[model samples]
Target chain A: MISPSIFVFAPLASAALFTALMVVRSRNVIHAGYWLLPCLLAVAGLFGSLEAHFFVVVQILIYAGAILILILFALMLTRDVMDPKQRQTTKFAPLAVPLCIFVGLGGALMMARAPWPAIQAAAPGPAEQTKALGLGLIGDYALPFEVASLILLAALIGAICLAKAEKEPAAPEPVIDLRGEIELEESVSAGAADGH
Target chain B: MTANLTHYLALSAALFGIGLYGVLARRNAIAVLMGIELMLNAANINFLAFWRFLAPNSVEPQVYVLVVLTVAAAEAAVGLAVVLNVYRSFGTVNLDEIARLKG
Candidate 1:
């Protein structure tokens, strides 16, 4: 019997692959960045079809929402938009194409040939899976979780330091001619008194 | 035929290949970062697929995926910062032009 998920999986996978191709092939960097959005959404859909409920949300939230926005912001900051005239690829593209094909096909072949010990058991319910995930995160994976947080903090600091605009030292305050100002004020006052 | 482990594996492999091509062939630094993001996503898909098929009851794969995601986020942040800095100093983010180390 064909699983219902195949319907979802097929379209999502095709979308992912197609958009991924577009991401690499697009001459305009902004267009490529836009193409990445659908590709990421398709990947999230794939996660959903796989029944990874938590991951579907995470994938969409982090990969699609946060990461894609970050990438677009970087693209804008770098002013890499609208360069259709420039060659997007390097001179080594011909060599890279064949090498990538070999690597991809070789990986697929290996995965197909490998004997996977796939269990026949159904996946746990989403609620139970989420609960277990929470427990495992704070239990067995606590150390790694803490480490990941540390890495994030460090990255935040490093990014700020690296991207920050260098500030020129403050120029010395302009020397004010106090005497001229006072003399001008006195003359104005004297003229007023004379008028009075 | 329904989608299975082999199908997911094949898809990920294709994604990985595309990402690899992007990394190697793209002249722009930001594009290379995009390629890296694609590659990381490919790895995440593989991890989740294996977790679902091989050990659905275990949370190991999920935890690993979380770690990978965290690292990916960090990498992107730091990498984009480096790229921004490069653009500031060099006035171009083209990898070929910024190859000062190439003797």
Candidate 2:
């Protein structure tokens, strides 16, 4: 009989692998970005199977939701994403097939030789896992958590500044136009009053 | 024929290998970033698998995964921002074409 885990994990894993391949292989940049969505969601599903409930939620919210959107925006801003002439793979791409086989099989063989412990599967109650992860974040990992938030804040500001810099020079043009319009309106009002 | 720790390990290894291939073979900056994201996911899978099979009761690995996710998000944001900057300076996002410093 096929195990339930197989039924769930197989599809998710295959979907992830397929989408990841599509993400790198698609000629259109926008299509590549779109392919990232399913890849991320499948990884999130894998996290759920591992009983990392908090991570599953976070993976979906942050990776699939936020990061993918950010990437899409970048693609739209940076490239003519619909252009079919864009090159998808480099000259070195053909090497990837053999390298992937060698590396993957070699790593798997090495791992198969390791003496992994026969510990119990993580069957932690989902609620308990979430609560424990929360407490640990606040209680034990608070310093790292704070540091991570600070880094994220810095990254956020840095990205904004980087993306905003180009628009800064052109910004004065709009302001100057607005001021001229205001002055023109005031002159029109004065003329109307005199006429009245 | 049940799925065990070794199976998860193999899967993670395969994913990591594929990610490495993507990283090395892709010319587009955004595609390279996608490759990096896949690599991070592979690492996260390893973390969770090890946590489940080797240290089933510990919450430490989960904490590490959380940190990884934060760093990954930050990396993505900064990476895409840089990609945008590059695109503005150069009319192309291809890494090979952006070699202005090649003295």
Find the candidate with the highest lDDT and give its number. 1
Give the range where candidate 2 chain A is weakest over 10 consecutive residues by summed lDDT.
A167-176
**Tens digits of lDDT, candidate 2, A113-175:** 888866565457788888887898899889888988998999999988887666555434433
**Native contacts conserved, per model:** 0.69, 0.64
- Highest TM-score model number: 1
lDDT of 1 by residue, B4-82 (tens): 8888898899999999999999988889989998999999999999888878889999999999999999999999999
Error of 2 at B72 (Å): 0.7
Deviation (Å) of B55 in candidate 1: 0.2
What level of docking quality does candidate 2 show?
medium
lDDT of each: 0.88, 0.81
Candidate 2 ranges with C-alpha deviation above 4 Å = A1-4, A170-196
CAPRI docking class of candidate 1: medium
User: Residue by residue across A17-50, what tens digits does model 1's lDDT show?
Assistant: 9999999999988899999999999998888877
Give per-residue CA lDDT, model 2, range B1-103, as digits (tens). 3456676777778777878877888778887898889889999998998887777678798888888888999999999988888887787788877789643
- Which segments of candidate 1 are over 4 A away from where they belong? A1-4, A80-82, A117-119, A169-196, B101-103
User: How many clashes show up in model 2?
Assistant: 0
